[model samples]
Structure formats: structure tokens, C-alpha cells
Target chain A: MLTRFENRPHALDVIGVSVAFGEVCVIDNVSFHVDVGSTLAIVGRNGSGKTVLLKALIGAVRASGTIRWAPETRIGYVPQKLDIQRDLPLTGRDFLNAKADVARAPATDAQRVAGLVNLSQSIVDQPIGTLSGGQFQRLLLAFALVGTPSVLLFDEPTAGVDEPEEKSVYALIHQLQQNEGLSVLVISHDMTQVQASADHILFLSHHGSYFGKTADMLNSERLQELHGPTVAHLRE
Target chain B: MTYATGPGAFLIPLGMAAAAGLMGSIAVMRRMALASDALSHIALPGIAIALLVHVNPFLGGLIALVLGTVLVWAIEYRSRIPTDVVVGVIFSAALAMGSLLASGDELIEALFGAPNTSDSFNLIGLGAASLVIVFIVRYRSQLVIRLVSPDLARPAGINVPRLDLLYLLAFALTIALGLRYLGVLLMGSLIIIPAATAMRLGTNLRTMQTISVAIAMLATLSGMLLAPVLCLAAGPLVIVIAASIFFLSLAVRRA
Candidate 1:
């Protein structure tokens, strides 16, 4: 069941976001706005700077532009992939509690978050290194949700999950967005998922880019010329 | 032969073991175990130089190892070169310099350790112990977060660079603390073996830290205890015990 978001005034304004490494301008003058309770999907092929744009949004990467977060805006970021060492003894609960104060009764807080992510207490107790890809992804989501941030950012949200698991994860995300009035910004490679999950699309390519309603993204002449044959299916 | 050992026999190795064990939990997790070996080797030339100049060899070794750590960090941070490769270069250069500076008895002493005695030595040991404790208490969580991903940690407002420099300094100090006891060739074992053993035995971060310290202390104590009986040097013996414990933990896990 999709829950509807409550009315909340929240916004993210990124203006002329540009990132360059030496001679290469990876994210060249990209800009967009995300309204509260909306999902914005950033789409691009590999090496098109989608990830760089995400990093720029969080101030993790230095960029020559303005990223204005609304006053009192809290952001939660779920990395596309965490390089978890196979031998590391960190558990799901520990991962969620990493940023929390130890004196704050993290065990109970972690359990609450685990439940929010639809994970059982036992699964949260298991070593993170031993978790399956889908399970780990859910744990990452739970970890992000620990602080109850108004904005949730995900990078390649379903990169390694199976098809069925991916759908379920997206459904969960949709429910959370509607229920929490959370603003979501995600980078995705799957155009079909982006179309279904995102309210707006930001399509990026080496030559040019477009940002508009999901329904209008494929019709943009700039995207058509830049993406050409590789993205023709997006029109459907 | 009568056992020619002093308070340093226990204090130096035990203090070093504690510091090394803590550092090991981070280093082993990052797969930088061999970097410790490289850093220790990089200290050998410094030790040789210190011997020639009649300066405190521990200070010289600490400076050299810290420089090596900084170089490795800088190179790994700036370029795509693998950490072990950069460390390997430093290790080889230090080895060549060490050989050029000292040989025969001096080389053997530098490699196997000699009796160290100073009226103020206990203060140094106490200081190292306090610093390691404070480090583990204050930054253990931050270190773990950074270990998971710098991208995540940075957004969470962790001072990643400061934390990194702090860890490296602690690592350098740990290696230097062990220099008079374990020597260059054997010191890195103290930093890796316990953590490996703990990884095999532990189920979480807290247990891993506890077990790492326990195993390191046990190995140091047992090796010192057996040193007199076997007529072997304590530094090398402690390392042997630690390795034995690691293999034993492996066997135990398999069982």
C-alpha cells in the first residue's frame, strides 16, 4: 500500500553544480531542484558523471556551484555500494548505530530502525559481511533512516539486488516516501525503474543533459541527440 | 646461560603489544597488515643512522616510520598506485640504507634487539599506554565509520583527514614503542598476528578488540616466560608465539 506524504515545505536547490578533475569536467554545470515529498532520479550511462553529481549534492565532492539546503534540512545518504571487508566483524545493528551516541540506548533505536526497514531483529543481529546483497541493501537503507532525516539520497539503489528484490525494495521506498513526506534523490541506470519510481528525471550525458517530468524526459531533443540509439527504449 | 633480562623484558613488550594490538584491529581490517611490515623495515635505516650519531634510536625510528607512513598515505591518496607497492619501495630503500649504514654486530642487534635500560623508561611506556587507551576510547567509532566508507563518514561530519593522521601517528608510535623490544624485522608481527587471530575468533567489533588485546598480551607474556627456558631472544620468541596463536586460531575455527 502506498502511503501519502503529509504537507511539508522542504526544498533542495542546486545551481550550476560543476565538478572538474584536472582537465576533465566530470559534472559540467549541472543544476536541479528537488521539492519535498518527491523523488528525483538522476539517469545516465556509465562515466556520465551521475555519481559525481550525487557526491556533489552532499558536499562530499568540491564543486563550483551553489547547493542550498533548506533551513533545518537533514539528509540521509545510502551509498551505492559499501566495500565491506569479508572478515570485518561489524553487524547490521552496529552499522546502524555507528553515528549514534553510545549513551543513547542505541540497541533499542537500532531495533526500531530495523523494523522500519522490514527486517527482523535476528537479521539485524547478523554480521553485515555475511548478509546477502538484498539484505545488505536493506540494512544500508535502515542505517540511513536511523536519524529520521527529511531527505533521503540513494546511489544506484538496486544495483546488485535481484529483480524481484529490486521491485520490493522500490515498493518499500515508495511507501516510505508517501508516509514520511521524504524527499528522495537517486542515481539509477535502469530507465524503466526511473520512469516508474521517479516523479522527475534528470538525464545526463557527455554532450548535454535534461531535467523535467519523467513523462517528458524521453521527448527532450537534447537527450535524444545525446543518447541517440542507446536510449531509444526510454521513449516507450 | 643466565637470563640477562630487566623490567624492560615485560614492560616494553607488553606496552607495545597493547598498542600494536589496537592498531592491528584497524590495519588488519584495511588489509594494511603488510604496511606495518614495510613501516618497520623503513625504521631500520633510521635505527642504523641513530646508532651512528649516538641519538635515541627509538626517536630516529619513529621519525622515519612516521615519514614512511605519511609518504604512503600521500601517494595512496593522490594517485592510483596500490598501497603495498608504494610501501614496498620504501621498504626496499630502507633495507638498502640500513645495510649500507650498519652490518655485523650492529645489524644483528638492530634486527634482534638489545637490552634497553633507562631510569625514565617506565614513563615512556605509561605514556604510550595512555595514548593508545585514549585513542581507542575516543576514535574507535570514528575509525570504524571511516573504515566502512570515507564518503559516508565525511557527510556525517567526521574529520576524516584528522582521524587518518591521528591513526598514522599512533601506528608510528606503536612501532617505535616496540623498536627496543621486537626490533625492525619482528615488530610488525606484533601488529598483525593478534588481529588475525582475533578475526578468526571474534563475532563483532567489541569482541574483536577484546580478543586482539588478550591474545597479544598472552603471547607476549608466554613468550617472555618461555624465553629463559628455551634460551631464545624474547622479541623473536614473542612473535613466534603470536604466529603460533594465529595458526592455532585458524585450526580452532576449522575445527
Candidate 2:
């Protein structure tokens, strides 16, 4: 199903991307491309520079590389856990409205996206800090859904959510992807979900990096070489 | 150092307090409560310099605050240092330099404001207050988004760094506006206390801002009215009232 977009135009192309902090190199000379309306799952160990690469792609960090996006690319990014204070007075509605206002989307877009994410008015009206992990994840997804972005970048979308909720979140993402035909780049630890949902995989490690069709790369001997013996456990 | 009588006296401080409240709400949300207080101390050395050179102290303080805000912004961006750490370091140096330059009485007045309200000062204060209020109202959404996360803001087409600089500038300006009435030592209290109280009580963003501004204005008014009766300085009295309100808010459970 996902291979249909392979013949279409490229949504993003990254060439020779490298990121360094002081003397330590984080992402080293990585290159990959994603076709329009396709899902690319980025997998890595804890310190493998997965988040850094995403930040570099979104221009949030300085990197020496060529990151070219198709013309008129509107990106919606859902970051990992934020360090927001528990007593913060901002409600979920405030967060959504703020995104809508900044993106120049209509004022009603907040309501529209809330419906898409299955967030009730009461849930969106509560202070963001008071939200449960699952509710907050939904809120973040709803925030990303505003302005009808063409590209969605998610960094550990289910980091704080429970096990059951994780599957639902992925389902919601898949539904949105199908409906909107969005190009998605997701950083996830769930290998099973990545295998089931993603069309392509970009695995980063200190040892080496690999990017190719998900099935081809998953079945290749290079996966074992790059990921070490832990590859067997990862598929569980 | 004499207090002004009549409407200009009442109106200017009220406006300044309102601006302080609004700015403080953001400051507290940004986790700059203590840092913001420290930031006010940066104005002290400027006031001392103004006293020595016979220039308008407010002007000197304003210049210093703007420069200090820029310095904070530059250091924060360049080194990726936490803002509180940077402000704390700068503040200590500023306080030391300020105390060394000014004598006992001059230092006391600058630290704990002796309002010598002039027509020019009133006009400038009002205008600055207006600017702060307008900016907060207009760009509140962007500020809220940026506060949540800069990554979120960048994708939404908001210029995060520029907005940060602008916010720092506005914070500095609000501090400067209150310097004449609250002084460097006490001005930060006027800003932080009311907002702290509001944070305890507010259910949402709009309520938070509204409660903060109202509390700030009320404290200013009560301080102005009760100062002459209590035979005390209005600046300190204003902070006292604001602090009292904050303490009072502690009793009410957040909904």
C-alpha cells in the first residue's frame, strides 16, 4: 500500500547531513529521502542522535547538510515530553488556539482538530498540565493537526502513554495519514509498530546507519551487523 | 524625593502596575520569577551613573535595562545557558557596582523608590505601560506557543528567537516603568506577586491575565491611598499588599 508513493515526487531529500556539538559529533554524514505521502520511521538507540537529526531537519539546530523540502511544505511537529510546570494556567484550548492563530488558520480549526483527535470540549478546556498522559498526547496530536500541515514530524509520540493507548495513537496517526496523504517522519522505539506501519526505515547507530525499504532492510543481514545481536530481541 | 498628588500620580502607577502584572504572568510561566527579580537589579548601576552625571535617572536606567536585556538574550542564545543563571550572575555584579557608586541616601532612594513624579516622567511611564499592554495582548498566542516549546512555535511560522528577544525587551521595559515608584529592589515584587496570586486562582490564560492585572492595579491603588495614612513609602506598601494577596491566595484551592 505504501509503495504506491515511491514513483511520485520526493517530499524531502537530506544529503550528507552532519551535526556536531563542540568536539562530539552526533549525527555523522547521514543521507536519506522520503517520497510524498509516505511514512519514514527513524529508529535508534538512546544516544544515537535521532532527535538531533529531526531538529536539524526542522531547522531547530545547526547542521552542515542539504535538507531540501518540496515547495509549499507546511510542517506540523509533535515533540517529545515538554518541561511544562504543573501549575501552568494554559489550557489545551489555549495551546490549540495559539497554534491556529500563529499558523493563520481559521479560528474554528481548533474545534475541527479536536474532533479529529477525539478530544471533547471539556478535555480541551482543562489546563494542559492537568491532562493525563494519553489526553496530553492526543492534545499534542490535535495541535499538530491544526493548519492542515502537509508534513508531520513526530518525536516519540507515545513516550508517556500507556501500552493500550499506544496502539490507538498509532491508529489515529495512520487514519490521519490516510485521510490527508501527509508525509510523516516519526522517531519511535516500537519496532513492531514501525514494521507494521512504516513504508521505509532509517536506523541510526554509533556503529553505522541504514536507510531503505522497511521490508528489505528488516530482512537484510546488514540489520544484524548494524544493530548487533539485539536485533532478534527488537523484533519481539 | 517627594510624592506627587492628584490624578497623574494615581494613574501612572496604576498603569505601570497593570503592565507589570501582565508581564509577570508570562515571566512566571516562563519560569523566570526569581530571574526577573534579579533582572531589575541591573537598573541599579545605571541609576547610580545617572545620579553622578546629573542626567535623568529613568533614562539612564531604561538604557541600562535595554542593554542588559540584549546581553541576556545574546548570552542565552550563544552559549545555551539557562536564563536564570545568566540573570543571577549579571545581577550580583550590577548590585555591587550600584552600591559602590552611590552614597547612603542616594542608594536608599534608588533601591526603594522615592517618587519625584514629573509631567515628562508620567507621560513616558504611561506610554511605556501602553506599549507593554498592547504587545502582550497582540502577541499572547505566539508567546503561549513559544512557552510550550520552541519546536512547536517554529513549525507554526513563529520566529522563536525574535519573539524571545522581544519578550525580554518588554520585560525590561516593564521593570523600568516601575523603577520610579517601586525602585529596583521592590519593582520586581510588584510584577511577580500579583501574577503569582493569579496563577493560584486562574483557571485559564484569559483568567490568569485578567486576575493578575486586576490584582496589580488594586495593590497599587490601595498602596497609594494607604501610604500617607500609614506614614510609610507607597512603593514598599504596594509590594506588601501584593504579597499579602499572594499569601491570601494560598488558602484557596486551585480548581
Candidate 3:
């Protein structure tokens, strides 16, 4: 029996999604759906295709299947590379002066600094080149906040950030979800952030694996068989 | 701070070089550096064939540009050549065919390369001519950065393959025209090197890009003077200077 996940579309849905690079399939014949305003976290090993799956959903990277975003869906993404380019001439102002309107106005250096209150103001006027790692990440985060995207995708959001900074990021994400009901999808290996933020977890193994509530997914027998009850121990 | 000695002698190379730098930087950052170069080489066959057929080289380059972009996209997105290796083969073959096809009296000059006989007036005038296209696609520069962030660029509604096409067309036109000044062997290098050198030191994309243009401008002026003094080919000389800048930045990065 086929699941109706493919038959009809919600706000955003993926059916029979298959993405491949060379001979190997990263996302092999997978299908999933997300309800409006729900948060889903994808978990897997480094090469386990979680990122590919997320990318497929956003229709960025190619996949063979149907991925329908809700009408007028504006998707935001923060890539794995945080310190992307500090040397671009754009002041923080230039970054916000973009197509989307997720953040507050004034979109100037001062406003951007105020928005990213974590950084000093002097660096705000400085061209993007001089930023530290956290600062760069902050800049992209601010960009992500712009345009009030209907959905947000963070690919390894905390990969290089410090622990405290990760907490701040999670805090911001939580605020977005709570205040605006921002439909968010996070791809990460960090167990705690997933447990903390993810309402739903999609554990993608070599093939499409699990999709359910985070707690339920964690409590599943396969996870226990694979990781020897580390998920249970983390409950404490 | 090493400024050129001659009055406005820098303008000629500056015009062509800056255009090349901007285009090439996008190519390099997108990891489509080889693809752009290959497309440039591919233009050779089209232009040469067009010349044989008594048509416009620019028109020919356009055809090559279309085919080149499609070929790379097919090889890159659709096929399994691992992107990098595929482009490598594409460029080598394209350059070979370009060299072989662009034969005749103009052929020698094209392959071995030639110095631009176009005066400062002509070069600067052409630069002005190209500004409209630049202004129209200015939004593209911002969008291009997203392409560099393979993770971020695509989902932002930036069709990667389409941008690749746009880039290939722009590069083909630029490359076909630029070959007159920068020449075949070294034009591709000059197009992208200044920006790449700056990327080493600069922390932000904008600063790196600005400095890249500035550096390319400097290298061009210096090469003009240095080529005569050392009795060397202008293109290779200019490339050497640019290469030195890259190494200098890498050293500074390590230091």
C-alpha cells in the first residue's frame, strides 16, 4: 500500500524524492510531509543525506520527484560555511537590502548592529571582510531573519559556532517559531539542539528511515539497536 | 601604492581587466572557474567556424557560449563526472579545438597571442559601452555570492544552472572580445586571478571584490611598464605579477 504523502499536497510536501550524485543515492526514494508551522529536524551521520534531503525539499539541489512549497513560500537558508566572505564590500546594510522582508526596517549599519546586538557597532560599518567567525555567522543569521521567510533551513547551523553561540541561535529560532510560527527545518548532528528545538525528528539513514515526534523517534527500537540507548540516557 | 608612471596608460588594461576580474571572480567563487575557461576556449571553435563561414565571431561565440553552458550543466548536474574532473577535460579539449580552428593569418596571433593595437580611447570607449549590461545585471553580483555558498545559494531561488548559463554567456562575450587585448593563453588567468588573490586576505566578499578590482588594475599598469623593461610578453608578465600577489597574500595569511 502506498502512503498518501504523495497523493495530495499540504503547505509543503515531498513524494518519491530521489536524489543522487554519481552512482550512489544520497536520498533514496524518500517521501515526507510537514504540517504548516511545524518544526522538523533531520538527523543522520555526516554523509547520511540529511542535508541532501533538506536541500531537495527547498528545490535548491536537484531531485527526481514532486516538492511543492506553499504558494508564495519564501524559503531562507543558512549554509554550513559560516565565515563565507568577510571581504565583500557590502556593509551589513547591503545584506538586508535584499528581496525578502523578514526583519525590521532601517536596514542600515546601525540598525543591523542593533539587530545583531551580539556584535560591536564599529564592525557594522566595516565591510563584511573584517568579521570574526561568530560575527560572520551572526551576519548570515541576520540575513536569514530578513524577508520573513515562510520556511527556514539551517544546514549544520552550529557546526563551527561555540556552544554559547549555538544556544543563542537556538533561542532566536525558538523566538521565530513562537512569535511568528516560522516553519523551520534544521539539519544537525548535535543531539541536544535537536532534543531542545525539534518538534519532529526525521532520522534518515542510508535510506529514508523515521519520521515522527522527536520523543517518539528517539524511543524507537531501531535507534536503540543502532546507538545502544544513548537516546534514553540523554533523557536524564 | 605602486602607481603606474605613464599618464592614463593604465586606462586601457584597467577597462578590460576589471571586466574580466568581475566575471572571473564569480566563476572562481562558484567553482565554475574551469567551466568559464572551457567556455572561453569553446568560443574559439565557434568563432573560427564562423570566420570560415564569413559570420560574426561574436555570434559564433554566442553559439559556443550556449553549447558550453549546456554541456557543462549536463556534465555537472545531470551526469556523474564529479563536476571538477568533467570541467577539466572540457577546458583542455575546448582550448585545443580553439587553437586548431582559429587558424590562418589571424590564427597565429590568436594562438601565440597578440598585444592589443586598440588605443586607450578604444578600450575605455568599449568599457563605457559595457556599463549598461553591468548595471542591468548588478543585482546578479549579490545573487552570485549565494552560488558560492552551494548550501545557501540555491534555495534562495537562484537557479544554479541558469546562473551558470548567464555566466557562460557573459563570459563568452567577454572572453571573445577580451582575447583581442588579454590574448588566448593568459586571458583566462587574468580574468579571475586578481579577485582570487584578494579572497585570500579579505574577510568579507565585498572588500575582497573591491580589492580584487584594485589589485587587477595595479597588476595591469605594472605589467604594461614591466613588459617593455624586461622585454617579455605583456599577458604572461601581467599574469606573473598577479600570481605574485596571490602568493604574497597566502604568505601574509600564514604569517
Residue A39 lDDT, candidate 1, scale 0-100: 89
Q: Estimate each model's TM-score.
A: 0.91, 0.97, 0.74
Q: Could you give the TM-score of chain B for each candidate, in order? A: 0.91, 0.97, 0.75
lDDT by residue for model 3 (A12-97), tens: 77788889977988887776667667777887767888877876776666799888788988777777765444344455544555
| Model 1 misplacement above 4 A | A1-10, A102-107, A218-222, A225-235, B1-9
lDDT per model, in order? 0.80, 0.90, 0.65
Instruction: Rank all candidate structures by their TM-score, best first, as comma-separated numbers.
Output: 2, 1, 3
lDDT per residue (tens digit) for residues B36-134 in model 3: 555556556676777788875545655775687578768776665665576577767777777777777666555434554433345533664276238
Superposed model 2: Cα runs more than 4 Å off: A228-236
Give interface RMSD (Å), model 2.
0.8
Say which docking band candidate 2 falls in.
high
Q: How do these models rank on lDDT, best leading?
A: 2, 1, 3
| Candidate 1: true interface contacts recovered | 0.50
Give DockQ: model 1: 0.51
CAPRI classification of candidate 3: acceptable
